[model samples]
Target: MEKNPAVAFNQPNHLPVCDWLNRAIDQGLNERTAPLARALMRVQEQLTWRYGYERMRPGLARKYAYAELLGSNGPVISENLILSVVLFAPKHIP
Candidate 1:
C-alpha cells in the first residue's frame, strides 16, 4: 500500500467546497487517473453541505487516497483533508 501526497487547502480557507472538488478533479484528470477522478466526481455529487474527511470511516478515507493521489510525482490534486475536517466536520456531526 502507498500513501497519497497529502495536500493542504487552508492558506486562505475561503474556497467553496464545489470549487475545491473541481480543482482536485481537474488535477486527477490531468494526471490521467480517470477512474479515481471519476470516483471523486461522484463524491462531489454525493457530498453534503457539511461533508468532510472526518465524517468518513477510516476505510473510506483510505479509499480516497488512491495511487493517483500518491503518484511518484507531486500530487496532481492537492487539498488538505484535515483542514476540510476542521472546517466542515463540525456541521456534519450527528
Candidate 2:
C-alpha cells in the first residue's frame, strides 16, 4: 500500500494554503470575502503545523480534538468569524 504523504512526513493533510484559498475565491466567494478567507487559511495553517496527526488524550469527552484558531482570544481575532479544526479518529466511521 502506498503511504500517505502527510503521514510519512508527520504533517497534516490539507491543500496548499494559498492555493486553496485562491481556488475557493475563484469558485464562488465574492471579493469581499477574500480577507476573511485569508484569515481562515492562516488559522488552518497554524493548527495543522501545531498538531499534525498526534494522538489525543484517552477517554476525552469528545471523540475528536480541536483548537480554536480564530476568535476573540485566538491568535487571529475576529468578531464575526471563527475557524477551528476538529480532528476525527483515523478512518472514522462517522
lDDT of each: 0.39, 0.44
Flag clash pairs in model 1.
Answer: 7-80
Indicate the worst ten consecutive residues by lDDT in candidate 2. 1-10
Worst 10 residues of 1 by lDDT: 82-91
Deviation from native of the Cα of residue 64 in model 1, angstroms? 15
Badly placed stretches (over 4 Å) of model 1 are 1-15, 49-94
lDDT of 2 by residue, 13-64 (tens): 3432322333553443457766755665554544432333456454332334
lDDT, candidate 1, 5-94, per-residue tens: 544222221224333456567767878687767875664443333324457665333223212222222233343332122111222322
TM-score of 2: 0.32
What is the TM-score of each predicted model, taking all chains together?
Answer: 0.31, 0.32
